[model samples]
Target: MDFDLPESAAAVREGVQAIAREYDQAYWDRCDAEKRWPEEVWRDLVAGGWHSLAIPEEYGGAGQGLLELAVALESLAEGGAGGAASFMYLLTPAFGGLTIARHGTGAQRREFLPRIASGELETCFAITEPDAGSNAIEIATRARLDGDHYVVSGQKIWISGVERADFLVLVARTIPAAEAKPRTNGFTVLLVDVKEAVADGTLSYRPIPKLGTNTVASSMVFLDEVRVPAERVLGAPDEGFAVLWDILNPERILAAASGVGFGELVLRHACDYARDRAPFGRPIGTNQAVAFPLARIKAQLELARLMTHKAAWLWDAGRPCGSEANIAKLTAADAAWQAADRAFQTYGGMAYSLEYPIARMFRDARIAKNIPVAEELVLAHIAQHELGLPRSY
Candidate 1:
């Protein structure tokens, strides 16, 4: 079997790498420290047309798929920005472009895809609620029909990029969970105009202070009687569980890519430092203690990356990829955390200093273990679904 990336994915890597290289670790460090967005890198990505990779050619895009988008995110993380940079691809192309391209009506496609392709607009996803957390079926966000529009009210937590987003892909309940026969029934997906809702005072958000990935803000979003046009329904009303799956699988795969890339970034830094810093008349890398753990982490990184690629490929092929996606995210998150921990250990106390990027990377690498999908939930899925065991939750 061929293990190589397709030519298209290779080209995506090269293109994104060229841009990522322009922004050094110091640049990212400054951005994180100042809690600033990397506008320069974003402009360069737009200029390079990387954002258009997933948009269909008919909609002013390159007509690529999730595999290529995952590659772009991974390469960008490995190149410099760490796992935090995955938002560049996740917020727009994966969540907006791919979802709308596949599930949106023709008019919806026409309205959003081209703008997304051209980087003229940005979108954020909102699914997790203050109480729901990983139990998405328990979400209480409600969107009731009001004539031609749906009046939505809900609270969403840990939503990324809301401040900068022009649009939001919102998941709400048209039928209350208690009333719906099947747990997944009664769900509806709506596309809300963020700026309009905010201006009307129906939508507001407060940023949550976080431990890392300070470059982009995550917020607690409140939607109170927000009106969304009926035309903005992303999929068939009250049958959005299927649409939610499509969005979720891609999210897991891209997040896996981010973890693998972040692992590579930290591992590279560890290897470089280990080879150069010789304190006791020999490079620390020469010792088995430092050398062996790095080697093991390198193996883990490669294995996780392979699973990530397989998940993305399965998604592009329109195959059932839930098992693969969960596995990829779980393994990649563990690998990234291990790599960051070892890298920090390899650098000794110097890792704590701001002069080095390890502390920042360590902080960034950690969030992947919990967000998008938690490691414990992934394990639960595998335990029940893959093993054919009884449901635990």
Candidate 2:
């Protein structure tokens, strides 16, 4: 019944907002124009310890949960950086820190968590393949046992932040989907040393030309006979479905937060422009056409944000949240896209101009519907799981 955010989560939002204020829309425009990472803001986040929200205090982190992390990302997006800024937290803290903190073996935790907490190391997730796309079970990446090492070879597409990642949380098959007894069996999650693999010529990547969110590069990563230590297996070998879900649910929740935040950002811009721009006797916002859609989107954004918080809370409480996560992602993506489209309309011809942040935000809001998980797939999940309908695809 309680709807307010916890005091700790509110503190995270305030802290991230303070940092985000230093980097205005103009700063983000420059970074987007140059296709550069927001290093200054990143360093500020590092100094503020925002990066360690999901890690355990025992490992030098704030010992927070996904709710706090989601709030931080939401605040960052609403602040002006858009959904792209969420990558700063998604790559290292959620994918690298939270996963290891929960599923990593004792030795693995000892080696990675402290550095991850300190922001000295970063990680990227590689699961989506060109052929497989949303169907992770069909991924052909293979890792074969070779003495104490697993020799891995595969290609992953649309991997984010690989250029800066020190490690890769890679999903590969020990046994092909065709050969495994259960479809989910035989999957293994490995932590690959990115620099070492690249130096030895076993790994390579090329950035894919993307429309928006240029702040971080999504790349086509190829691993050719990469050798990973056997000790690097993240969870129980051949039982990686659990680990994958652990990674994916939080990812969807954070993506949902990003969507909700982006919606708020664009809606704010649209409202500002609608109130001030007066081509006629009165402001454009005086028209219900201008004001109603924005108002409707505002309602949708708040609902999506509430679901996002619920999903995050369920995750932090170790409750099953697959349905909530998917719903949050679906509703939030729709809200963000609608908000951006409305904002574009509100700006009239000026939305296309780079002088305003609307153009960049318009582009960034779109990919949320497709990436992390597609809106259609999310709907299908709800159809099957929530309603107990027969599975589709």
Candidate 3:
């Protein structure tokens, strides 16, 4: 509502920017080409406490809200897409932390929060399966109670950070659809020990080769009767959909923020090139053809930023932000996609080259339009939830 960041928020944004400046486009380009994770830069973020900024102070985190988290993510992206968004992906476990904080038993929180806050443990979220994708109710992953532990067995695709994660905040069906209270019921959320799961051969993961974001590898993981202790379960069995929604809203908001930052980075590069590159003995920016499109991109990016901030605010205030978060992701993904296209056009031939950061951001931006939630699904949400239309699909 204020439309201005407070002093502490401003410092958080500025600090993230300063940290991101250490990695340049050239470094990001090399990492992408080599498909290497930015370990050193990630360590820098860990040491800076950037990874735990949103975890509660009582749990040894900075205890900031979603607005600050969005600002931090955007600042990282402002540095460059790969450079900034990598941290965003790395710190994704915090979304799980927030879910646990809100719903976990005191024992579950005590067991995981301190380690997560200290960066000794990193977590990957598992909800989107190959078959289920955005329709989470369709998730077939199953977790069955067996005395003191739950046996989980399922396959999850696009589960990021599994290679280095200490644990996973996993979602699986606990009751069959026929027995579920509603179509969304019968599911449960579990905090599984990654090391134990791997060591016992209950979980096997192979890195998913991806187009970008190589800093943290995505994984296709098979959970083969993995044993998650009863103490590790968060919230309740057969009622995780609500908790998953809370967790996902922040993920959407964070992704939208990173998209905003990436859009800004592309626009900045294009603007500089336009001001300096000459066509017809004058700056290319002099042509309305070039300048006008970039101007429109800048305007769109700002609008997306506002939507992202609004979503962040609502989530931070402990309000239901499903609609706002969905819209922010939809708008920001569109803006980033449009900005990437225009920025590439402004650069002409070089934009197609792997040497250019715009190309990488462009590829990454295209993914945002689909991953986490698709643009079509977001539009459907708006039509059904806000516009009072019947559900489609």
Model 1, C-alpha of 215: deviation from truth (Å): 0.9
What would the per-residue lDDT of candidate 2 be over residues 1-393, giving only the tens digit for each residue?
999999999999999999989888889899988989999988888888898888888888899999999999999999988877779879998999999999999899889999987778999999999999999999999999999999999999999999999999999999999999899999999999999999999999999998989999999999999999999999999999999999999999999999999899999999999999999979999999999999999999999999999999999999999999999999999999999999999999999898888888888889999979998999899999888999889
lDDT of each: 0.93, 0.93, 0.81
TM-score for candidate 1, residues paired by index: 0.99
Off by over 4 Å in 3: 82-93
- In the range 159-183, model 3's lDDT, one tens digit per residue, is 8877877878898999876678788
Candidate 2 vs candidate 3: which has greater TM-score?
Answer: 2
lDDT of 1 by residue, 1-393 (tens): 889999999999999999998888999999999998889999998888897798899999988999999999999999998976789889988889999999999999999998988889999999999799999999999999999999999999999999999999999999999999798999999999999999999999999999998888999999999999999999999999999999999999999999999899999999999999999999999999999999999999899999999999999999999999999999999999999999999999999998999999988888889978989899999999999988888
Model 2 residue-pair collision total? 0
Between candidates 1 and 3, the one scoring higher on TM-score is 1
The Cα error of candidate 3 at residue 261, in Å, is 0.4
Model 3, position 369, has a per-residue lDDT of 90
Clashing pairs in 3: none
